[model samples]
Target: MALRFEELDFQPTPMGEISLRRRYDPAARQDVYEVRLGDEYLMSSLFTAAERALATLALDVLDAGPDTGPDAGLRVLVGGLGLGYTAHAALADPRVAALDVVEYSAPVLDWHRRELLPDTAGLATDPRCRLVQDDFFRRMGAAPQDRYDAILLDIDHTPDHVLHPSHAAFYTADGLRNAAEHLTPDGVFALWSDDPPEPVFEATLDEVFAERASHPVRFGNPITGGESANTVYVARGRAAR
Candidate 1:
C-alpha cells in the first residue's frame, strides 16, 4: 500500500523554497501529486485541465490554418513544467517536431528527470522534449533566433496574481509584443490563468496579435466535488515586429 502522504523533494531556490509532495486521496482512491513554492500552492495533479488545454488549444490553432497539414513538424516552447502535463499533452501530438520546456527551478526539472511523477514518466528522456533550466520571462525578452510555431505559458497564476514581481511586464502590450516577436507570423501564443479571462490582458493580446481568443476550461474539483475553472488565452498572427 502506498503511503498516505510523502514529501518527495524540497529545496530553496532564488525565487523561494519549492517542494513536491504525494498523497493518497481516499475520496478519489488514487495518489495525488502537488507542487508548492514556499507557503503557496503552485499546482496539483487533481486539476490539470487548463494545463493540458494550454497545449492542445495552441496546437489546434497552429494546425487549423491552411498553411499547415498533417506533416506540419511544428516547434513548440512551453514556459512551465508543472507536473509535466502541458509538455506531455504537446508530445502526444505527432506534429510537434521539438518541444523546449523552460522551468526556472532546477529541483522541478530533477523531479521529472527522476520520474517522480508517474503520469509524466519518460518525459525527460523523450527525444522530442528538452527540459531547460532558465527563466522563461528572460527567454521571451531575448533575441528571437529560435522562433517557435507555438509558445505556451503556465507559470503564473494570472496577469494580476503573479508568483514573482518580475513577471508583471508580461501582461502589458510591450511585453506581449516582445513575446510575439519570438513566434512565427502564423505561430500561436497561449497562456493558462487561474483567474477568469481578464479584459486588460486580452486587450493586450489583441494589440500584439492579429487574432486572439480566450477559453474557459472547467473540470470537476476532486477536493470540492464541484466544477472549477481556469482560463486559457490563445493568440496568433503576430501583428508587430
Candidate 2:
C-alpha cells in the first residue's frame, strides 16, 4: 500500500488560514472554489481597500450629526457580514447602541466563530448584536421595531455578478425605494460597488432619497497605478420630497 497524496480540496495561504483550488463547472461555466483565502482578501481580490473604506465612510456619515439625548441609542443595519471588518468598525464606535448583522451564508458565520476569522464571536455574542440568518429582503420585509441611523450593504462582488442574478434587484430603483422606506429620517444608505454604476442608477437614488452623493476612492497602486477607477455610492436617505 502506498500513501495517498491527492485527496485534499483546500490549501493554506500565508495571509489567512484557509485556501482552495478553484474548480470549473461546465454547467455553471463558473470557477469553483479552487482556492479561497479569507473573505477579507483574495489573491485575485483587488478591492480590499474599497470595501473597508466604504464601511469607514458609512460610519463617519452616520455619526456626523450633533449628539442628542444621553441615550439616543444608535442602531445600525449591516447587510452582509464579510470578514466582520465593517461590524468590527461599527462595534468600535461608542455611539452604536445595537448592531444587527444579516448574513445569508452559514459557512461564513461558522468561520467567524473561529479565531482566524477576525474573532467575530465577540460581536456575534454581544448582547447588543443580533445575527439574522435569512435573506436580506425577507428580513427587511418584516416590520422594523427600531429604525436605524444607517444602512450599509455589500452583498455582492459587483452589480454585474452572474453568480447571483437576484442580487441585481437588490440594487434596482424599486430596491432602493424599499430601502428608503426602512431608514430613519436623516439616515444614509451606503452601497459598495466595485465600480460606479451608470448615471441612471444615481437618478433612481435621487428619486427616493433627498440628498445624493457619490464618493470615488482609489486605494493601492498596482490596481489604480494605470488606467483604472473604482467608487462607492453614499446616498442620504431623505424623507419623501
Candidate 3:
C-alpha cells in the first residue's frame, strides 16, 4: 500500500493562515483536495455531496419558477470557491448565464487558476464564471439592489459556527436583510451548513425573506463508513417595498 502524502500550498491572509492541499488516498484510489484555515479543516474533496447540493437545490427551485426560460440569462453569485464544486455545478445548468464567485483567499483562487486541484472543470477560464478575490459577506452587503438571481453561500462552517467573528452578524436578522437587498424579488439564497437543520436560523430566514426551505443532504462518509448529513438552507428574496 502506498503512503498518503499531501502537497500543501500555504498562505497568510488577513483572516488567518489558509492552506490548500492535495493528497492521494490509497483506499479511494484517487486524489483528494482539502482546504484548511490554520489548523481547522474547512473543506475536503472526499465529501462534496452537500457542496454540490448547494448549487443544485438552489437552481432547481429557481428553475421551477414560471418566469425562467431557455434564455432567461440567470445570474448567480457564489460566496465560496472550495474546489470549485459549487461554481462547476452552477455552470452545469444551461440556464445559468453568468456566475460570480467571491473567495477571500488569493491562494485558493490561484490553485484553481493553476489547475492544481484534481477537479477544476476549467472554472478559471470558463466563459460564464468569474472568480473575484473579495470577502463574500462584505460584497453581499455592498452589492447593488437586485443584482443577482441567486446567491449560494458556503464559506463558513455553519450559520451559528463561523470561521471569523465578523461573519457571525451575517446570520442575524439585520445581516440577512442586508444580504437579501442584493437579490431579485424572486431570487433564491441558498447556504450550506456543516450541521443539521437549525430552527432558530430558519426563523431568522423567515423573518428576512418571508419564505424559506431546508433540505438535509445525507451522504456516505468514506472515512467513517457511516452516513453523515448537512443542511442546505434556501430562501426567497423579499419584494422591495
Highest lDDT against the true fold, candidate: 1
Per-residue CA lDDT of model 2 for 1-241, tens digit only, reads 3222222233343334444233344443443332244554332323355666666777787654346764366778888776666677777777777778887765456555553343335766777778776677665655666677788777765656522566677567777777766777878788777666658777878877877778777664452355444567778856375
> In model 3, which regions exceed 4 Å deviation?
1-3, 64-72, 143-146, 239-241
TM-score of each: 0.95, 0.71, 0.92
Q: lDDT for model 3, please.
A: 0.86
RMSD of each: 2.5, 8.4, 2.6
Colliding pairs, model 1: none
By lDDT, the candidates rank as 1, 3, 2
Q: Which whole-number lDDT from 0 to 100 does residue 121 have in model 1?
A: 96
Worst 10 residues of 3 by lDDT: 63-72
User: Across residues 133-187, which tens digit of lDDT does each residue of candidate 1 receive?
Assistant: 9999998888887888999999999999999999999889988888988888788
Model 1 scores a TM of 0.95
How many clashes in each candidate?
0, 9, 0
Top TM-score model: 1
Task: Kindly report which residue pairs in candidate 3 clash with one another.
Answer: none
Q: Write the per-residue lDDT of candidate 3 for residues 1-241, one digit (tens) a residue.
A: 4337675688898878888877777666777888888889998898889999999999997753234564358889999898888899999998888899999889889989988876765999998899999888887668574478899999999987898899999999889888888887888999999998998999888888867999999998877778999999999967343
| Deviation from native of the Cα of residue 205 in model 2, angstroms | 0.8
